[model samples]
Target: MDWFYGPMVQMHALLAWCSVGLFLVRGLGHQFGGAWVMDERLRTLVFSSHLLIVISGISLWGALHHDPLYEPWMTAKFIALGVYFAVGHWALGRGEFRVIGYLLALLALGYVAAVSVTRQVLLGL
Candidate 1:
């Protein structure tokens, strides 16, 4: 966990959280018709960062030689990631489902953070 590993992981973590802000912007901008938020370039940038998020996650996983499939917290976080992607898709689309997607994305963000902090898949337990 030296410079290459530690710094990259930290950078990716920062990127992930920043992406969360972009997620909020994209979702909220839908209601406000914010030009930058609705821009294709913004969407592309945000989506592209997801690739980094995945790559960093895998890199860290490999660095630790950790198997997420057998790890309950990691498993749950992955599940939440899936939900976030699905909901984010809907959130990016047009029509009534956007609201649902927006709320779910927010919840998923919180869930991911909580899981990471608590090291617990089941939050209350």
Candidate 2:
């Protein structure tokens, strides 16, 4: 298992960025009246990418052996993940609030990145 850590980390990071990029593309395309954004194939790809991201994240968590209950940063990341998912749902939906939701989702992603890097629940504050 020790030898698996490096590759797993790389895989998880790559999948995370890929998911975000796909979301950005979909959101922008939908906003700009691109019907292709709603294509079944593309939706499936996005769904698959997100599923992989979650799977890889859990794998990494298990590999690291970090207890989330004892790690404030992990707890923060979990909360931010929930926010990202909820806002992402709204962002990809039909409504005037879509723009706001999109931006908020991005913000939540940024917070997750920050916490991941700094391991600080409070971040800059």
Candidate 3:
């Protein structure tokens, strides 16, 4: 399955990084009072990417045959993904607290990326 799995994994990784930037753009646009139309465009892009991201992620998960019940790293990766999404959503909100959310989202995104690369909960240390 290398032919299929390889591209699936690559697509998932690319989308994950794109997601980080999308949240940053949306958050900064909201915090800085950027044009509403532009913000909407970014929002739409983010929303549209979600389906593709899910597809790629699920494909990778199946390709790896990850059993969260037995694999701690896999479980942690899933949890980190949830945290990333929650923080991104919070960051997209319009309020004084959105700045904090935006910053937290970046940290969460980093955690997700690290886990994906290391395949470890604590960087295998």
**Which ranges of candidate 1 are over 4 A from the true structure?**
none
Clashing pairs in 3: none
Error of 3 at 14 (Å): 1.5
**Residues 1-125 of candidate 1: C-alpha lDDT, one tens digit per residue:** 68778787787789889899888877888756666776788868987898898888888888887777777898899889889888888877777768888899889989998987786888867
Query: 2 or 3: which has the higher TM-score?
Result: 2
lDDT of 2 at 19: 83
TM-score of each predicted structure versus truth: 0.88, 0.93, 0.87
Clashing pairs in 2: none
Q: How far does residue 111 in candidate 2 sit from its true spot (Å)?
A: 0.9
Name the best candidate (by lDDT). Answer: 2
lDDT by residue for model 3 over 39-114, one digit each (tens)? 5676688877887898888877787888889987778878877887787777766656878887887887787778
What C-alpha lDDT does candidate 2 achieve relative to the native structure?
0.89
- Give lDDT: candidate 2, residue 9: 80
- Candidate 2 shows a clash count of 0
- Candidate 1, residue 68: Cα displacement in angstroms equals 2.0
lDDT of 3: 0.78
Winning candidate number (TM-score): 2
For each candidate, the alpha-carbon lDDT, in order, equals 0.83, 0.89, 0.78
The candidate 2 region of ten consecutive residues with least summed lDDT is 25-34
